[model samples]
Target: MTAAPRPKLSVILAAYNCADFVERSIRSALDQQGLSIEIVAVNDCSSDGTLAVLQAIAREEPRLRVIDSRKNLGPSGARNLAFDHAAGEWGAVLDADDALQPGALGPLVQIAEEREADIVAGSIRFFSHRRQEISGAVFREDAPITALGLKDFVEAARPQNREPDYGLLKPLFRIGFLRERALRYRTDIRHGEDFHFIVDALGAGARYILAREILSYIYTTRESGLSRTRVDYSRMIAETEKLARQAPYSEDPMVAKALTRRADALRMHELNVLYGDATGLPSKLKVLARSLTSSAGQRWLKTKIAKRVVH
Candidate 1:
């Protein structure tokens, strides 16, 4: 008898202390129909029973490959390791707490092949585990497919925009495109790493297209997620600053404008932190004065004052 062919897509999942949700995530990937896919899961030295859970699942599911890490490599490192071991032409990221919709990979792969795109993304539905309900879709549904270049992506990521970050939308990327460009998530950044990776891919001139027709991914907003537990304003500011400075298209006028907007948002975050930490009236005044010194701070102050007056 002939052996089964290799999967066309590899779903890389970096799991850390996610024993409660990892099994469901793996099962979701395995349940994907109409496509040949493999789940490459790496347990990053999870303090919980995540490793044992993964190992047990792997024994039952042949397509699920589990890697046990000796040290805690975090999400980026684990994902990089998984990428090296993946044998698929296309790669997809699946968070341990999240799951993919049925028939997700087939349509994404078709789009990538048809357009010769390096990245093919679709809408994501945000599901609140606490509420036990899916909130809504992330991407706009008006267009069938929206093509984006580096400049366009940067602009859409601006703070003033109501649209969701394209990074939050799970994308099916060509393995060759990522390997050829040496695109990997930065291990240094704890938060906003996904955004940085997406930016880097776009900056490296990867063709990105959004398929608005299908909401293929479900992003579960769990109470245990980093966004809920971590509030490191300074680290976030530094990451955004680094992104602006190191972007390949930093010299472009449009990219520059987007960077400026991001910088302004960072400044606003700083001002908010300062104000929140102020103990007394004098301290609050000092914080306000310091915030008003910079152009971004001045705008933030004006906006705050405007809201107060309106109320």
Candidate 2:
């Protein structure tokens, strides 16, 4: 009798100067149960030992594949490179510094198979430096933001102010859905590209499935990390606005409300971080006053955009 085809899943990890953790990360992907995983890793021109580590892992594991770029393309660019090479029914965008827990992928893939879900999200267990589960909860586990019922579970997962530490973990995704929607990582988006990718996919009416199981994702909270530095305050604000504008809001009131609220919050945060002036105190206060008079929730957004022009 002929052997059956290997069960395949493409795990894409973008690494930049993550030599300390890339090996463990690769091992986590390899250790996953009941899946023939093609580990597609990209070394985004890391000055550190990231490439060597990936090469070493590739030698040990035949399934592991490494793509080396001569120049540093950011996370989105690296993932795009791997997307071209991925050959699997599902794709996962995993960070290099973080790792997946054993037994996470099998069940997640099962959800995708049964529900025919384009995107499958699972609960997260956020960890500290010591690799302990500090907290856990479903992403956007609240009303209003999560009130889109099944949709909130699919995209727009904001976990703050809900549970102890709510977050959206690694989402198992259908490769065909991404191709059909013409969705890929936005190259210009550095801070929240992953979030934007998922939302954009959902905006195109992509089917979603939520896996209720909690996955222990080891997240390192080191200061000198790529994640800490990528957030351009101005760009983050603009991307949120873009997301709000692009969403098919009329289709779902809950999604509409959540997008509006999220946009407002992004505006507020950006203004607080970047909306300052050296052009006299009075002029700044006048600008601030105009912002307040505009709208209660969206006033900050006006100020944020105006600051972008003046400063």
Candidate 3:
């Protein structure tokens, strides 16, 4: 008897109370063409029958395996567990409420193989029922595939208006590179953990590339999703402060300046979150004006206007 071959890609999906959408997410992953794929889905102690849904889907599909988490670990912890159980050369983290584009894995894997890149990210296609389509997150459709370095990533990471938020891009990683470095998402942070992970990986000298020629992921925007929740920018401030004091990020002048700007943005964002409901437009404008003083705010607003202009 011959053993089964390992899959080329392992998609680690961490689902938390997205019962209505998990099945579709799992199906999209299972339907990837031109490659053998495994869906490692972790049910993060969802009370909404998400576990049952995952189990039922798993029973019929040999490629899909569902891990029922005993406790409610956040997104980072759940994805960490899924990645540990994955049996693939390359791995990607997928959200339970979102999905992957058809035949997305082949090109990514090919690029990794040819370029020897440790991390590869592709632009996301925003999907909405009310709109034809949303804008790209990482790069425009016609943008050439570009090498993404630590400095580039940090600069683009600022809460900016015109630059692409690389944090929004879902990147595939070489399993060995991550495992060897003991790289995992930070469980302490409920927000901005993905950004933390990428920054750490890039700082560790991982060769990262942006493949924008082909859109790889489908981002399903839900009104009730966790993304709608206010970000814990205080957590971001504290965590980034720690990074700012440490090496690599602290050593480079450009990176240090960018981190300072980001920290200021986080501070401003934190204040806004605290004072969420203002009296009227005047108060809101006052708050907005205050935030715009920070470089991150200015950059974010600029790109936002640019997006409107292009579209």
Candidate 4:
């Protein structure tokens, strides 16, 4: 009898101070079925017990490879390092703080191969540490997984805005596709790096398929995490403006509409933050003036004028 061949996948788990949740995240990647999985657990010089936890896990699981950095590098640097060390046919980016559901990887691999897709996305369910067994406030399911079908699914997911805020759907990617396109997370931006990365992949003519059958990711919301910080509204507004101006969807009507909606939503959220009670009078006044003087502000004004004139 012949033995089954290993389907190679490189799973990169970028860790930085995720000690409390890193174990679960690694286990999820390790649990993947029907694949020759190499887990690259890169520790970005976490001050917490993340490195120790990763070491313990690595000792237990032969597939889990730990890269403990001497100095603190951000998520982008960690991910890049992991990818550099990974030797697999496919690559999956797994956040250190998140968990993958059972039997998630096989479906994505199947869908990507069957559809000849460069990228395959699956559904995600959000959960919070505080709310035990409460499911989540938001869960998203992408379109049906058919051969070469992603336009409708992309349209449906466009307005979700923040990439990581929603797009944890699936985690199977062709390593060759990333290497060919030279797609790496941008290290400069803190808030919207994933968004920028996705746009880059899309612009590079990447093909997409949906893993519609599986719940591939479990995204956790822990209040103690970095996500709970107050936003720099002025900076975020600028980011939104840049996103609108630079998104490759300027020529695609549906995508353009979705981008516009996302821009508006982000601007509105930031505006509230700028004007919210937590802000002081001088800061509020400065932000207000900046908002009115911004390029986005000018664009908004022109759009309103054009709408009224047309109406």
**Steric clash pairs (candidate 4):** 122-169
Error of 4 at 245 (Å): 3.5
What lDDT is obtained when candidate 4 is compared to the true structure?
A: 0.67
> Taking the tens digit of each residue's C-alpha lDDT, what string does model 4 give over 67-129?
989976677778889988888888888887677877778778877887788877676777676
- Candidate 2 C-alpha error for residue 3, in Å: 11
Task: Give the clash count for model 2.
Answer: 0
Error of 4 at 7 (Å): 5.4
Q: Can you give the TM-score per candidate against the true fold?
A: 0.88, 0.76, 0.85, 0.76
Query: Could you give candidate 2's per-residue lDDT for residues 133-210 as a string of tens digits?
Result: 445544444422111233463234442334321223467778878887778898877776776777777677777665
* Pairs clashing within candidate 1: none
lDDT of each: 0.81, 0.68, 0.80, 0.67
lDDT score, candidate 1: 0.81
**lDDT by residue for model 3 (1-311), tens:** 99989999999999888777788788888878898899998888888888888888888998988888889889999989998999999998888767888888789889877988999987787777356465555556778788988878876775643655667788999988998999999888888888899998988789998888878888876543533224677788778777877897888888887777667666755654544766788986776676676665676556556877999
Cα lDDT of model 1 by residue, 92-154, tens digit: 998888888878788888988899899988888877877788867665567668788877776
Name the best candidate (by TM-score). 1
How many backbone overlaps does candidate 1 show?
A: 0
Where model 3 places Cα greater than 4 Å from the true spot, the runs are 129-138, 222-230, 265-277, 281-311
RMSD in order of candidates = 2.8, 6.5, 4.5, 5.8
Better of 3 and 4 by lDDT: 3
Better of 1 and 2 by lDDT: 1
